[model samples]
Target: MNEIFVKSLPLKDVIANIAEALDTTYFNRCNEYILNIPEIYGEGSIRGINFLNGFGLIEYNCTLKEALKIHFNVNSIHPLKFIYCSKGSVKHKFEEHDVLHQIEQFQNIIVASTQQNGHILIFPKNENIHLNSLEISRKEFKTKIDCDLNILDVGLKKLFKDLTARNLFFYQGNYSLAMSDCIDTIKTSKFSGIARSLFLEGKSNEILSIQISDYEDDKKDIPKRQILRKSELVQIQKAVQILKSELSKPLTIKELANKVGTNPTKLQEGFRYNFGLTVNNYLNKIRLDYAKEQIMIGELNISEIANNIGIANKSYFSRLFKATFQLNPKEFSLQIAKNANKRQRNRPLT
Candidate 1:
């Protein structure tokens, strides 16, 4: 058994204390706390930024050299956390539960723990973990709902039903692609200072909205014609990786299916079931997003971007871009340039 570090405080203070305990330096910008742990902790880092007074975003990326357990006994208010494990895994042990709840990669977990008896997180050694969490204090959450808890999704309502109850509620599910995209944007954003904080805050709230909407959609009685088994799910994910890796090549659905050792039907159904997009739609989305990124870089022309993304018909690519982003490729490129110019002009004299 590894040694556990226990702390009883509000969430933000707990994060700062963890950095201090590990002898790390942290930046306390207005509402953002960026903690960079030393090499002794295996290059661990945590970024916490508050949006509202009691609502915030936490991004954790680390490879620990030793096991660390953080037991958080909430001091001020019971907190509700919406957590996504993007890269690795984590285990949560509640005070009242004997079983450890596992949050694996590509999964989301929602937890509401009482202030009197909070939860614990155990991080194992030598494994790279990336987690993004959206935390809201109970009081703030209730205020946002106008004190009408009934407006929450059934799953969320159950998790937060009895705020005064001294028990922990946990719900775990597969996160949708929309949520994943938001997380990736937040992770890879190049903005800094106030721009960075605002970007993170907006994306965090977008993730929360997507999660709640997805939960409600799951509750609806959608037809289950394309049910995929566990092994088939793995195969489809491999296909996705292959598609992403070979983006420069124009691969047909048949080629993709054969490469992943699955039939075309199963591959198509898997995309629909797991990713909520048809085969062509998904591939087009990938290509368009890549093209838009290249435009943002301001390095490639519209036709060159189209060619690089394997689309020879520039007009068709422009139409796809319009449909996806409501902006044609040229218009989007000009917008990026305009924004860059504005940022340069707005820079303060130092």
Candidate 2:
């Protein structure tokens, strides 16, 4: 196992420390630090960005050849950490605690070690580990003009105000689908310069707020919070049925979302989580499947088939059909007709 100690304060120093320990180097872009893993070590990179108000984002996407242990041993009051495992599981243990927590895919954990204590993150060997950590320095966070920590509810106020780390804090639960989208945006962000800095900072703040809300909802034991509610499932099913029944009519995502009594965001998420396809893609699949069935039935020509399956243009339908099945709709339909005629001719006299 390889052990890397990050004895630093901010993201820049932390990334620099890792890069140095591995005998490689890191680069800086608009205050964001990126450490590309040396080929001798593994394939992947560790990147991080820090905002002025003490919030930071660290992304680790890697498949290391051996087990790696990253120890954050910064002294003084350590930064609060909101860690989310997006792809693979990771093991974590506070320096002051013996219990190790495993954060699996789609799960998050909020951890704050006691004063001068630190965090241990363990990534198993040869696994695709992808996670993001939102770190906030409470002492510095309180100084932000808009912080207004006192206005926050009692529990969050106390949790954020533990400057001396009087209480060791740790909470774990599945993250919300909305937060998953935010994280995905962070991953796919292409901005640079001031835009990059501002965008990342905004997203980091959003993730933190969602994390807080999720924690509060967890404490309240809200069944409809992070977990998908029955209503949502029913709406998803209803959306599918609507699409199936309206094969000759295409609906916009907004229209579908509205008919289901849900917003576009939730509808999009429902499709992603439950159906594993985008709304438009799923609709197109349904229409094309119906068109195939209609063609195989030998009742409609290509143009009629397209019209019946919500495709106004035969050329477009043909392109989609070819793309999906690698066969022309007209040829496929004629072949079906030919097969039926041949079978009819081969039948024995009754």
Candidate 3:
């Protein structure tokens, strides 16, 4: 029954206050703050980088030692939240729904321009979690950009029409690779100081843009595909899990479809409708993401990384890696090594 109250403040302050409540000191450099919880509190940590004008990125990767609830009060103007649960789950209830809404792994949820006093989030104990959240203050958005709001998707337009509304508009769906890439860039970028702040700001804006574009695409695709039955949705989700777990195996779409108890056409259509990617495209995206992660670990050579991800042709793997990340595998590996070395040199003597 542990509870934490978070007042509406800039994201950096929010993070700082949480660390204080947990009796931990946060490492501060430039506008970024990183908190590592001790074993008594939890395992893992929280990292956040904020822009003074009100946009910020907060990343949480932790396992709570006990169940905890968070109450967040939105005191800022035109507050918006874009949240993705890359691992584990969290639950919350909106004003309109009596039932709790769960954001599970590989899913995303967005809250737009809510005027509600606050919302509650619950985290279960001993569950490993990874969450990335982007917060935007509409005032900051307006001051930073000169573009017309009408250029955005209709869904976003309606969300912004009445900034004073007590009820918030919500959007939830499968997290897209495009959105994932933006977050990966923000997390792995080697920049520091002002350069790091600027990199995060650019990445945050890029994520917002991708969300809008994805919303528009979903709107168009909704009409074309028939509504999926709950059972079908379950099967498609199972397929996704299988695909992720079996990255090292070369499984054709037909094989995946059969394994998931669906046909090729339904499988392909279901993937596009539910996840916004073709089977091949989604597979490739996950493969490249895995390869990138391995490269970042700095424990494997480029060929080893490629082979571990099921790519037989190292040259082809490099091509796909470059296409997705805009950097060749070797170059990306070198960058990760350079960053690790810099951090090592900067560490203070114990």
Q: What digit string (tens of lDDT, one per residue) describes model 2 on residues 1-350? A: 99999964688889999999999999998898999988888889999898887889999999888888999986678898989988889999998888999998889998888877899999988889899999888888877734577666576787788878878888888887678788889779888888998998898889888887777766753423344422356788899999888888878888987888766766777887877998888998998888888888777778887888778877888899989888889788778888999999999999
- The deviation in Å at residue 206 for candidate 2 is 1.4
Q: Which residue pairs overlap in candidate 3's backbone?
A: none
Error of 2 at 21 (Å): 1.3
> Global CA lDDT of candidate 2, please?
0.84
Q: Cα deviation in Å at residue 162, candidate 3?
A: 3.0
TM-score of each: 0.65, 0.68, 0.63
lDDT of 1 by residue, 198-236 (tens): 887788778888878756655655432222333347888
Q: Model 2: clashing residue pairs?
A: none
For model 2, what is the alpha-carbon lDDT of residue 35?
96
lDDT of 1 at 194: 88
How many clashes (backbone N, Cα, C below 3 Å) per candidate? 0, 0, 0
Worst 10 residues of 3 by lDDT: 222-231
Candidate 2: stretches off by over 4 Å: 145-153, 222-350
